[model samples]
Target: MRTPLAAVGLVALGVCLMANPLFLPVAVGEPDPAYTHTVQPVGADAVAGLDSPAAEARNGSDLDAVVAYDDLDPAARAAFDRARDAPEGGFGVEDPDERVDSLAYPTDPRLGDGLLIVERDGERYELWTRTVERESDVVLVQRVLVQPIAFLAGFLAVVAGAAVALRGRLGGE
Candidate 1:
């Protein structure tokens, strides 16, 4: 009796994990409102300007410049990458006034078409930009773990259910 009940429970657990009916949170990404906002739609030319070296030189200080996505420092790049992976388009920024991580994926897709804002030490730098693409480690890791777990659970459930069903014939009720 107990064995059969346990088998059913295992099957239920396996199916639930596979289906993810509850929408359990996975390691998607974090959100930082400080670096996130809807931007005004601008022309592609405007975005190109943000990536120009002239924009950096015109900032009057190297500490503050409108940098392109490819030109972003390692830390800033990682943050934006995480934002791109977020389920709800979340962003991550350490400090708006000191780091480029302060940038966020535009809340609206249309807003991200061309312009982006950067701030460093109270100075706002409007930068032209385009899209950035990167794979998320969090997402990769989730798939790696879930797939195996689901397979193992399903196998065990079937075995257990069979054992319960055959217990009487096996003379081990």
Candidate 2:
């Protein structure tokens, strides 16, 4: 009976640990600047191509000329064309040695020259700036979750101690 009760306690503890959000790793990445813009050339071209009414008319379809850059509100569509056309690594430093070969975990954004940027959708998005500081509590929570077996062992020790104490009291009675 005591063995089954202890097993249940162990299982409950495992569930509790898994449910804790603090055990999860913080997703590290660059933070985007407020004025930054991401313009995917492929998507932009596709939108442009579709806006051509002549092409649609020639094809005998309900075609509309792709919206011109001028058509876009100046305030909403920031000047991203120049940034998009420029060569990669224009925003920040690139780590040539850092190869993204593994998919097991996400690569941490590299920091350089007070900025960290990641290229996505043919646009650079800032993930972080200046220094990347890790939260201390994140380290403590991860340390505990990393060694789940140790937690189980500690729990078993407590159960064993309790059983021994109970047995002693009963024997004395």
Candidate 3:
């Protein structure tokens, strides 16, 4: 009984080691600064995009994909175009680590990809949202949830294995 239990524990341990739950790749490739945008605080009541047509049109996009200019509503497209026309307005540096007056950079110059200037509660903000390569859903789940659970299970099995091997010496029937 103890031998079989020990074998099971060994197998579980091997599975855990092979899974490598510690280093899971969530986002792939080097993070580009072009996609890195400043989310500066415009005002306390800057909730313009919460229910606006522009926000509605931008729904259901893949995490890796940016909202295309054509996909936005007329109002959004106009704002986008206007923002693209003059890409000099700086994103205010609020943090000590942030550089002063960081300008917006487009991912694709021909596509007119760049920051979107928005005014809410009479305050302005420059938004050049992040776009990066991310791992698939299956791999994400395996790394985040499944692997950790398996590792824990393997650890528990090892403990059980030791207990089983020591049962006779520990005065258990």
Q: Which candidate is the best by lDDT?
A: 1
The candidate 2 region of ten consecutive residues with least summed lDDT is 97-106
User: Model 3: how large is the Cα RMSD against the reference?
Assistant: 13.8
Q: For candidate 3, give the lDDT of residue 33.
A: 39
Comparison by lDDT, 1 against 2, better one:
1
lDDT of 1 at 172: 78
Candidate 3: where are CA atoms >4 Å away? 1-19, 23-122, 171-173
Q: TM-scores, in order shown?
A: 0.35, 0.30, 0.38
Supply the global lDDT for candidate 3: 0.47
lDDT, candidate 3, 103-164, per-residue tens: 33444321124444444445445445333334566677777887777777767666766666
On a 0 to 1 TM-score scale, where does candidate 3 land against the true structure? 0.38
lDDT (tens digit, per residue) of candidate 1 on 1-173:
67667667766765665564245336566532334422222223444344457646757443343446566677655555554455644443435454344444443333233344444344333442223333366656556776667667767766666776577457776
| Candidate achieving the largest TM-score | 3
What TM-score, to 2 decimals, does candidate 1 have? 0.35
- Tell me the lDDT of model 3 at 139: 72
Model 2 regions lying over 4 Å from their true place? 21-36, 42-78, 88-173
Q: By descending TM-score, how would the candidates be arranged?
A: 3, 1, 2
lDDT of 2 by residue, 1-173 (tens): 55546655655665555444554544445432222223333222332232346435658332232234444344323333434554651222233222112101123322222222333444333322222233465455556665455556556665665665566557732
